[model samples]
Every structure is written in C-alpha cells, then in structure tokens.
Target: MNIEVSTANMKFLECFSSETRVRIIELLREQSRNIKGLSEALGIQPPIVTRHIQMLEEAGIIRSELVPATRGMQKLCILQLGEATLNFKRPEETHVPGCHRTVVPVGQYADYQVSPPCGLVSGAKRIGMCDDPRYFGDPERMNARMLWFARGYVEYRIPNYLVRGERPCMLEITTEICSDAPCSTSETPSDITFTVNGRELGTWTCPGEFASPHGKFTPHWWTKTQYGRLKTVRVDGSGTFIDGVRTSGMTIEGLDIRPGAELRLRIASLDTARHSGGVSLFGSGFGNYDQDIEVNLWYDHHNNAETGS
Candidate 1:
C-alpha cells in the first residue's frame, strides 16, 4: 500500500534502508528460513541476524513463528509484505484543477446484489460474517474498508455537489480492484462494467487476483490470499478512458448529471460479460493504494456553456 514518509512510519522505512536487511528480505521472499540458516547464508553472526529480524518484525515486513527442529524449536522468518510504495505526498495533498472530488469507502455502498463468495471487512474486523448476503445489510457495513463478491454488482451514490449554474463536463472514478478468486488466487480475467447515473459507461477486464505476496496494508489477522491492482476509469465529454486510454465510445452526455441531480455509480460483473470471474474492491487500510473509490467531476461554471445541463 501507499505510505507517506513521516514520523509515524519512520521505523517501517528504516527497516528497508539497510543493504543487509534488504538481502534478508529477498532471501525470505524465496522461502522461509530460520535464524541459524539465515546467519550461515548471510555470513553474519546469529546475534546480528537476530537484531535485523527483530527490526523487520517490528516493521511488519516479516513474521516469525516457532517451529520444531532437530534439537528444539526455532523461529522461522517469512516475508509478510508483498509490496510497499513510498508516496511523497499525502492523499489530501494531491489534487487536480477544475475537479470536484468525492471519496466513497468501499463498505459504504448504497445498494448491492452479490452472490456467494462475497464478504465485507472493516479495517480492524470482519463486518459480520463472510459469504453471507444477509451481512451486507448490516449497519456496520458502512464502516467497511474492503468487499468482494463472486458475481453481481455494488452501487454507490455519488454526491451531486454541482451548483445552479455549474455543468459537469467530465466524470472519473478510480479504485483499487482485482478479480475475486474465491478461496484462492488465479490469473483468470474478469470483465468489470461501470455505469454512471444508470448510463452504461464501459467495461474493463481485470487480469487477475494476486497472491504471491500479501497486500502491503493488509492486516496481520487477514488470512485471505488475494489482492487487487489499482485502476482509474474516466468518462468525459468525448468518451470513456481506462488508465488514460480511451476504451469506449460512450461519453459524458449520456450520464445526464444535471444540476441538483443525484448521481449513482455502479460496478458489476455482468452475466453477459465474456469473463465473469468476480470482483474485489479495496479501500482505506485494505489495498495497495490505501484510498477509497474516488469520483471526480470536472464542471464548467459558465451559464452559457454548451453542456446539456
């Protein structure tokens, strides 16, 4: 997940600053190793290896477990972090001109139709019960930081902040997501479609759910094996764009987000889609981006602007 350089994460950053520590991390990524094995492989003293292991463990970069050995139990070290990104600026510090933005937490979905292999989790705890559709109705769902479903759609309400004379010229929705492989990781693709205010925008095919390394921000308690990739989908006066490249002929006028109108954003794995794999949406404290579903509206304030509004 994204991390800003600050006092709060100084220890975590420091763990990766040393060459020796980086080597140890690389070794463990290949396979879990005990302290004695690490010392011999790195040609370092056991005490020195222990020190580095302690620091890495404290930073949540690796985890250790006592396992049975020839003579006694040995602490086995395993890499825990799959990836880490250092962000120069905090989320709020980054902004674009002429855009009105709204951030929606994944768990705050206004409406949803999901099947089995679906679940919700807050930053620190599971929302209710996994794979149970009834849990989606729980009030605690509003606090969700992550959600997944094998099929169907999740809809979010986008706040209509446009004033009397403003007209939306562009719309953008971005989030960290991946194919939802129930109980496992897979390279199978999934076709995810997007709709804005009931107007079909376009569909994106997610390559797969990654599990080789754990999500950077995923908590220690989370034992799930899938993580997501960050993606940005945009729809403007011209057409739809995925990660800056135009992918659809549908344009902003089709959305018809008039002044004072309510806006809804829906993401679904349509039954008609070629690849109906599944979907996992990640928000704060759950994915590589450590952010929520971001909706941006670029508007024209001129009363005489040609926007259909």
Candidate 2:
C-alpha cells in the first residue's frame, strides 16, 4: 500500500489534477463507499462524483466493487495504492544540445536469426505492433520489434584506441535486461539487475505500467494498442545507476572507466517472488523506442573527464 514517488512514478504523482481528486481519495481511504455515500458526504453533484471517481480509477488510486445493501445494488469504491511519497527537485541550469557521448555501436545483421524462444528482432518493423505474441523478435526489422536473450552477451566494441598509453582500469557497457516478457498485453512488472566485470552493479524495478505509441511515436489516428509504459537504462559515468532500489533519490557510483580495459555488460533477472508479475519487454528497436539499449564508454581521453546531464 506504500506508493513511492520519484521521477520514475511521474504519471502517478502527476495524477493530482484537482482538489476533488485529493478529497475523494481521502474519503475512500477510510472505507469503501458507494457513489451515493460519496456524493452526500462531499455535497457534490452526482456527475461531479462520477467524474472524480473515473479519474481516480484511471490513476489506479481506488478500486470499486458491487455491494448489495439495504438498497437493491450499490457500487463500492475503495482505495488501492496508498502510502504515497513524492520527491520534487529544482531543475539545474545548464546548456548542452545535440551532444551525447553515445554512438550506435551495433551494425545491422540484416540476416540475423534468434532461436525459437528468442533472437535479435529488427528495429524497423517494430514500432506500434508489440501487443501481439508473435511480434516478439524478427531480424532486419527496425523502428520496433527486437528481442532476444541469453546468459548475457556483449555489444558495442570499446575501441582499443583508448588504451594507447594509459593503464587499464575499468570497463563500461550498457544494455537492458528482462526475465522474459510474457506473451500478452498484460501488466507485467519485473526487476532487471545489472553486473559489470562480474561485479553486481545493482537492481532496478521495471514497473511495466505505462503508455507508448501503439503505431508511431505520435501517430495521427492512434491505431496501435497503447499498452503499459517502457524505460531505457542509459549508460555513462555519473549517470550510471547504482542501487536504484526505491525509484527515488537513487544514485550510482563506481562507474569510473579504467584508462584501458575491455568493458562487459552482464544483465540478468531474478524471480524472487517479490515480483511475481513476470517479465515482458517492448522497445522501439526490439519491436518499439529510438533504438535498442544504448551503451557508451566513459574514460579520461586527455587527463580530463567529461560529464553528462
């Protein structure tokens, strides 16, 4: 019942649109109430009550059930997610445009193939058609529809050029991981933890419960199935994710790149029963987003380190 709000739960925290929503949630928290009870207690019109209730339901703040009382029938609404905690931070002032240290490292394996259970899917043919069980993985595709997994592999070659005359220290590779996204358009929560050079980097909770372009980034007609939201784990020096356990105030460390060393990205998932919701993935490149997992190497190019926002 505890709702931890960080930038990750933007949608949930942003659901507070009106004071009615706040008051309605307060009343529902005490006990499940029918529309008539809410309307009478709040002294509001029936239409207003209904409108607020709908918004709360969409925000997943309350749940409703049918209760037969002295009356013929009554719909009872109760609070769902609770213990809400939110963190607000002031925006830092800085300016840097069209500058990302990352570069697309993997070349298109036009004739790539994945085993029956999985393989590389083309990013071209994947935008907006991910709800289907069959659109899992298909090579040579782009713009969405790409998924494949194994004991963890490596992509994005860290150029040996960085090892010219410096001592090798650390390696940094970035990618996304999943337990195995279910074959349906259902809400599936997962925890994809990362490890670097055999070191357990940390764990991240992927609350696969958001929206995306069903057919395109911003389609005109909205023909595709707008399912749960998605996420992209970006890689860099300070921006690296550490113990992001609470989805709030989470920070990362130990990402300093050794002057010269091969970096490896080791991704794995644990079904600790803590998240029995199961795993499901849909990215623009994997079957939908800008591209597959983006990875980059951060090192002291000339005795000076660079920073990313």
Best by lDDT: 1
> Model 2: runs farther than 4 Å from truth?
1-100, 104-120, 123-145, 148-179, 209-256, 271-273, 276-288, 300-309
**Deviating ranges (above 4 Å) for candidate 1:** 1-97, 304-309
- RMSD in Å for all candidates: 10.9, 12.0
Compute the lDDT of residue 44 as modeled in candidate 2: 93
- Evaluate model 2: give its lDDT: 0.44
Alpha-carbon lDDT, every model? 0.79, 0.44
Candidate 1 similarity to native, TM-score: 0.67
lDDT at 293 for candidate 1?
Answer: 91
Worst 10 residues of 2 by lDDT: 242-251
Q: Estimated TM-score per prediction?
A: 0.67, 0.40
List, residue by residue over 132-248, the lDDT tens digit for candidate 2.
333333333343333433222222233343453332222233332343443423245556655554555556654442233242332334322232223334333234332111222
